[model samples]
Target chain A: MELFTPELGLVFWMFVTFALLFLILAKFAWPVIIKMLEERADMIDKGVVYAQNAKEQLDNAKSEAASYIAEARKQQAEILREADKMKTQIIEEAKAAATVEAKKVMDAANLAIEQARKASEKQLRQEVSAFALGIAEKVVRENLASESAQTKLVDKLLNEVENKN
Target chain B: MALAALLLAMPAQAAVTEGEGEDFNPKEIIFHHLGDAYGWEVPFSHSQRIPLPVIVRDCQGSWHIFSSNRLNDGASYDGFYIAHGGEYSGKVVGEQDGVQYRPLDLSITKDVAALWIAALVVLLIGFSVTRWYKKHNMKAPRRWTASFEFLVEFMYMSVIRPTLGSKAKTYAPYLLTAFFFIFVMNLLGLVVIFPGGANLTGNVAVTLVLALCTFFITNLRGNKHYWKEIFWPDVPVWLKCPLPIMQAIEVFGVFTKPAALCVRLFANMMGGHMIVIVLTLLIFIFAKFGPAVTGGITVFSVLFSLFMLLLDTLVSFIQAFVFTMLSTLFISMAVCDPHEGHDEAEA
Candidate 1:
């Protein structure tokens, strides 16, 4: 008994209003709305994908930069090593040249000292021979002054000369 | 004015004096009336009386027989005390242990309180859902918004899209709105959290209105093809002879579809409520005379009631789906061009 009571007027109006509203919505509103929603979703998805790719690219670039920096450091160390080697070679060559020059100078001074000592020794030998000859001459003159001794001395001298001959 | 004067003069003569014997408590009588008439008492003991034929009011100030014992737990008061039948008139019994109370006068019991409670629940649910929507941004649709979107998608894909085809997107808003509205309303009927104890979906008027809306939309949007199929048929000469009769019947069929929608929703919701009420009443019927019977019946009632409640929850969703599906089917049929040779060739 409680189930079927009718509110006739309300039922009529509800039908009318809903019919009008649905018409307007179906014709004008729904298509634009759904399209907009789908577009928005697609845009967001694209943006996210782009951001991810950019981040990956950024990471790659950072790694490449780090490698370049490392390579530069290595090249700098090689150049410094080469410079040190060149400096040491130049110093060694100069020292060798100075050593040769010093040896040449020492050889020349030794040659000059040898020549002077040879000349001095020759002159001293000649002077000593002359002094010996003079002393012998004086001794012979004193002996000849004794008379009988003179004749003997003369005969001895003759004998000595003959022996010498 | 006449009625009021009559009421006052008649009641003045019947006033009772002190020491004229123990007067019945009018408040107890009123409470008893509410409990007995519609089972509005609090259900404590299983042996308590089960109220039958509960009555309730709606937001429109209309009275209706909401459910039989089969659909609702007879109204319980203060969480106990199944109301027993009574009608008594007496003076105020004064305060008893600091609790002030009034006696009751003889009157027929009504269930306006129960009806009010049901309305309040409907209002609360509406408020809560609206508040939830307003508090959160739906542009990006997070959490609950996403959940609602999925639900809307499911309904569109499974129901409207298949039926309406090219026009499905255009019909999605109406279909989705109707689905949610009916779903929420049906769910409200199953939960009893209001002051009095009411079931809004049990009311026939609401179902009728919803059905009427579907009816108008279906007919208003009908194209030439729909009318042609109903009013004329392509058949052999012999069949064509009786075409007029068929056309007349087909015209009636148009109205019947929406009528069926109304009845289907109303009946299912009302039927589910009745079953739950009856299961609850079983406890009182079995336990009225003894504690042992009462204890056993109480357990049985609780289990059975829970089962029915679960079924009602499922039915609420199903009814909403069925209504939307049928409406979509009707609209699609109306808008489709049956005379198109392409469809005929394909078939």
Candidate 2:
């Protein structure tokens, strides 16, 4: 078909028309359009970067705060442990002091008891001798009237006294 | 007589398309529709039509300009008649001293007028957009500016960004312009009502010129790596041998790529026009049987033609998009760095 045929004049005109169209668009239209695109992309990218930086800073602050709390908790535990140890030492020292005081009181009481027991024994010997002497005097006065009884008793007593000396 | 009634009824700008008898010549009607015309045919008005201005240069290099009605109204003025048959059939021919010489018929034919109309409209739109950008450069765009900006952004991403990548910024001006130009031309072709329905892209001359531009840009800017890849592909030694068949095919591919791009657009667009014409012509074909048949088929014909028109509009936009995408793809392939090509192979 002649429909597929080419015409030179029309071809030439088409070239001229198209070239003019292209030139005008390229010069007037494209730069502004492209710049707008570039600027918008840059804006989006900067926003993302800013968001990421903020998130990172927030994360850092959170971690630091957690570590601070952890340190505070550890200090609290150490203080409690120290208090517990001090309470045990104080209890043990108090126990030792009470034991010493009790032993001193017991020793003092025992010495006093020993002193009383010696004194009592001495009094008991004195009383027993006195009673024996009284009885002997009474017997001597009443029975000396019988001469054989007094002489035999006096000789045995004198022999016993000489052996004791 | 049936063909005359049918022709008068059809709302086409084709000047002369009638044939003899029931064997109606659809070719004459179709070609008349496709070809340049002297005057636009107004339906049901045999003596009345919209006349185009005829401009022609004589053998003496003198120019004659007049209304096309003079040539069509059963008359020839100053020895020049719009030829009705043969290769120069719708063009003006001058009978200079007994020799029928075809002068330089440089009239603003139907498609040429359409092209002018398209160019002016595009320029007006572009100027308005530029103004809008100047005033509201900082704020978000509204109305047509928003849609236009969106289109620009889409081309930038889909065609420019993927193909050119980093160098997209550099070639954005040309790529964006080419996209809009083709899109507008195709869009105008779909408007059957008013002054917009002329097949500019269907003309081989126009598509050839467009393809030539792509060819020039692709090759002129084509790097050494591109040419090298064409000549020496990464094939086995045995494959590279055997009369350099692969290399020859690679080189041939470069030329055919643009040819294919232009032809595909032209054929798709022209095919739509043909189908619409044939569908409408069927009613007249059925008229030969009886008035009953003609009346019955007219309703169906009108409905199918309406459907075709809607589909044609969609095709127009799609064709424009395809042409722009392929042209950008070719340019990208030509100017891409060797490493980019390597990356493609790896991918």
Candidate 3:
């Protein structure tokens, strides 16, 4: 029966001790611990979000860098092609100019040789005509030493002159 | 192992022989061990005990305070003594020939001292957790402090939060405090030593106070729906108006919740302690046969006691969990919106 009975003293003390314990803990301890727990959870969530943003930024930067490299490579190829075209053009122009210079030089040399040959032919023709005329004069002076022969030749010459006129 | 068992069983054996030269009465010894006292019985010696203060008022209405050592062995002091053979047996009584009256005993008995010790232990745990969080904000603490954090998180998240939802914050402190208080007391009762032997949780008076706290909190915090359900439940008009049968049952359920809480914890703890004491008393109970029988039974008794102590430790944790869970459920039922129940059923 005593086991079932609730003693007044024990009951009084239990209420006092337990009530004070609950009040003190609820006021001082629970709030701080629970707040910290919530704060930690919030921090973890924020950290995850921040990491996701950083990864996205990293991905963006990687793609941008790849595009820049590709553009740079394209520019390099364009410059190389232009340079090769310029090199071929310069080589072609040099060959053409060399051919033109050779032709001009050959034409000038042929003109000088033609002019010299013409002059030489004219001189030779003049010299040959002069020699023929000297031979004809010597033969006419020998034949006039005879009078009869001179009268006959003078008549024939007059007749031939009249006919020619 | 056997030597340790004997050492652990020594206190019960010593208590049985303290009355000296009388036949070994296991019932008296068991009850003495179960009951609260003014002095703490130390092991291996019953003539001397750690005396506590006895605060009493005599029949003359004068207050008296003295050390309980003066009342040893049925001794009397200043016309006040421990009554041994009456309705007031094992209580301090006034000097009278018959029908002596009991004084207003406000002494710090073994149970009260044990209560104080248990409260101190709980407070220490609370402060230690607070200190860890204060020192290193979000960082997890190590060792026992970490375990304490796990227990708090587990209880709040799994039990309290699921039951009470947003109101978990409001009631978590009381529930958590009750949990650690009951748990520490239950564990302390299992140890048969100076600081650990008082059966605080086994006392009906202590559990009554605990249940009362829960009772008051549940009723006071109950919302309109809760009261409506109790006074005018959602039932047929005939059941409520003609006999108030459904309403009566609803009202009965409200009181029974807390009553069940009180008795369940007290009886479970008391039974555990009683079994251990009875098993230890077997050595003396079987001594009349011979040394051989006594020796064999002693071994059996000690082994069973060791097993019970281990089981009680587990029971301590479980009962603490059960009490907190039930309290949370009750509070949630009172405060929860009726619409939520409908939504849950739909889902």
lDDT top scorer? 3
Q: Candidate 2, residue B308: CA error in Å?
A: 2.3
lDDT by candidate, in order shown: 0.56, 0.76, 0.84
How far residue B190's Cα lies from its native spot in candidate 3, in Å, is 1.9
Candidate 3, superposed: residue stretches over 4 Å from native: A97-165, B1-7, B10-12, B15-22, B59-61, B95-97, B288-299, B340-347
**Lowest lDDT block of 10, candidate 1 chain A:** A6-15
Candidate 1 local lDDT, residue A49: 100
Candidate 3 pairs with clashing backbones = none
**The best candidate in terms of TM-score:** 3
My TM-score estimates for the predictions, one after another, are 0.49, 0.71, 0.84
Better of 1 and 3 by DockQ: 3
DockQ of 1: 0.09
How many residue pairs clash (N, CA or C atoms closer than 3 angstroms) in each of the candidate models, in the order given? 24, 0, 0
DockQ of the candidate models in sequence: 0.09, 0.36, 0.52
Residue-wise C-alpha lDDT for candidate 2, range A1-165, written one tens digit per residue: 557887655776677787888788778877777677668778889989999999999999999999999999999999999999999999999999999999999999998998898898889878878988899888887888788987988998999999999
Q: Encode model 1's per-residue lDDT on B1-347: one tens digit a residue.
A: 23222222211222222113365333332222212233433323322334444333323444444333433343432222222232211111223355433222111122333333333443343333334445652354456545655565567656676667667776686776567656766775565432322343455655677776677777888888888777775654465465576677779999999889988887897777666655554544464469998788767766776777778889998998998999888888887555442353243
Q: For model 3, what share of native contacts is present?
A: 0.72
C-alpha displacement of B273 in model 3, angstroms? 2.1
**CAPRI quality of model 2:** acceptable
